[model samples]
Target: MNAEIIGVGSELLLGQIANTNAQYLSKQLAEIGINVYYHTVVGDNATRLKETIHTAQKRADLIIFTGGLGPTKDDLTKETISAVLDKPLVTDEEALQSIESYFKKVNRVMTPNNKKQALVMSGSTILHNNYGMAPGMAIKVSGIEYLLFPGPPKELYPMFENYAKDYLLSKLEIKERIESRVLRFFGIGESQLETEIEDLLEKQSNPTIAPLAGDGEVTLRLTAKHADSKQAKKLIDDVETEILQKVGPYFYGYNQTSLPEELMKHLINEEKTIASAESLTGGLFSERLTSISGAGAVLKGSIVCYHNDVKQHTLGVLNETLNNHGAISVQCAKEMAEQIRIKCCSDIGISFTGVAGPKVQEGKEVGTVFVGIAIEGKETVVHHLQLSGSRQAIRQRSVYYGCHYLLKQLKERD
Candidate 1:
């Protein structure tokens, strides 16, 4: 079924808040093979919301409304929808009791305005709110479904997941589940990846391929719909295999997973402890690594040897090497990686040295990065990358490349 999402908030239009609920809902809808054709953002104005609903009703069968389900004056979502459908605004006694109980339990004075949250349209299925005051409702008037959910993400996400999702699913005749996978790539340009898979996109139908470019990475989302989930996954895998036949070398991880997460998993599984020596990334590589739970088993530590003096005195890089090639050189990266491994006594050492910039530095242009990896019983290997992005983007991408490189090495050894 085709769906349209309406995000009702003056705060959203004013840029005070983001419409993340639409994003979350769209993903949920897509899993059940529902197409979210349009996302409309309306302010707290009742007339505008009514117009939005009128417009959506002409095109979409499912209209999901988020926000404006609060005690405040601006919360006019349900009122407007009720007026448009000519449904009476009836008070949900259960929701009103819950709100009253909350105030009584907390020993706080209950303002009369709190009753606003308990308003629901008559002849609607009450989607109970477990998170907050506003209990959402799903109304099917004239065979067109309208779901009104709370504004706060904490309240909206859970309410939708618990009640609204099931309500929508029961209405839908979904013969298949839509499974999607994202193949993340760095080092390769989006244009290049697209050019390579141009034919696939041009003739795409089942398991469609979509390419998206961002700061310093490219992601290809592969989606397939099938009655059997395993068959759907196999279709996605087949599409991935076809794409990987040409551009597999640049592929890193899958949906919602990054190079750092994948690298940590590999490192943990291999029983290898690692450390990082940073110049440009400022220990960002280690920072990401340690952010993962149980990383203490695989990550030793890191050193931010940003200054030449720190590189010399702490990590013990030769003064001559620093004076000769500067800190951005591959030799300095190699030394930094080796020194950190020696110091941390880890099985592997990684280093990031680069000119991430808004301007040039040390006779090198911005985005010039050198990733050095020193593994036990192997010569220190350096991978130089001439990246592109702002200083922060370049630094973060350097960390990603570091993980990619480390993962590649581990895979090769295995």
Candidate 2:
């Protein structure tokens, strides 16, 4: 079934708060094979909300409303929807008792206006809110379904997961399950990755392939639908295998897993320890590694050798090599990686040295990066990249590249 989510709040339009409720509802609806085509955000005004409801009713089979279910004067979602659908508002006795008991437990006198929280449309399914005072409601009018939820995430999340999900599922005539898997890739641009799997995207029907780019990474979301969950998953797997045959080398992890998380997993699983020597990135690589749980067992330490003096004195980079080729060169990176590994007595050592700048450094243009990796009993590898972006972007992308290269090395060993 097709759906539309209407968020009722002025704070969303004014940028005071995000409309996270729409995002959550869209994902939940997608899992039940419901396609959400539009998300509409309206202020607490009754006229605008009624207009939005009219528009949603014309195009969508299911309309979900969030927010404006409170005790204050501005809370008008149920009243507006009742006017549009010609449904009278009635008080749910059990819900009224729950709200009254809550105020009694808190040792506060309950006001008469608070009774409005328990008011529901005349013929609707009451979704009791376990975490808050207002109860959510679901009703059907003129072959269209309407579900209302609270604005606060703490209350809305549980209400939808426990009650609203099953209510919608029961309304579906054909019970088709939808499954989606996101394949994450670094070191490849979105356009390039799309080109590599263009054929798969074109021929997709049961399982669809969509590419999305964010934070210097590309992800392909594979969604499949079937009555059998295992069959749906197999459809996605077959498409994934076909796509990966062309671009598997760049694929790092699946669905919500990041490069740092994947790297930490490999390190801890293989009983490997790593150390980092930073120059331009200023210990960002090490910081990313240590942010993951169980990092203490896998990360030895890091040396932020920003200046040439620190590289020579602390990391023991050869003064002659710095004098001849400079710190941004491959020679300095290789030496820094090897020396940090020796100093920390780690199984692997990685180094980030580059010109992430607004100005040229040592006659080199900005975004000239050199990453080095030295593994015990393996030949040291250094990568030279001429990147383009702001200083912060360059630095962040450099850290991602470091993780990518290290993952590649670990995969090769495996």
Estimate every model's Cα lDDT from 0 to 1. Answer: 0.91, 0.94
Worst 10 residues of 1 by lDDT: 167-176
TM-score of each: 0.94, 0.97
Model 2, range 1-414, lDDT digits (tens) per residue?
Answer: 899999999999999999999999988888888999999999989998888988998999999999999999999999999999999999999999999999999999999999999999998999989999999999988899999999999999999999999999999998889999999999899999999998888898989998999899999999999999999999999999999899999999999999989999999999999999999899889888888889999999999999999999999999999999999999999999999999999999999999999999988899999999999999999999888999999998999999999998899889
For candidate 1, write residues 1-414 as lDDT tens digits. Answer: 899999999989999988999999999988877899999999999988888999999999999999998988889998889889999998999999999999999999999999989999999999999989999999888878889999888998888888887888788786568999999987789999999989889988999998998657899999998888899999998889989998998888887888889898998888999999999998788789888898989989888998999999999999999999999998999999999999999999999998999888899999999999999999899999998878898999899888888899999999
Looking at model 2, residue 407 earns an lDDT score of 91
Could you tally the backbone clashes for each prediction?
A: 0, 0
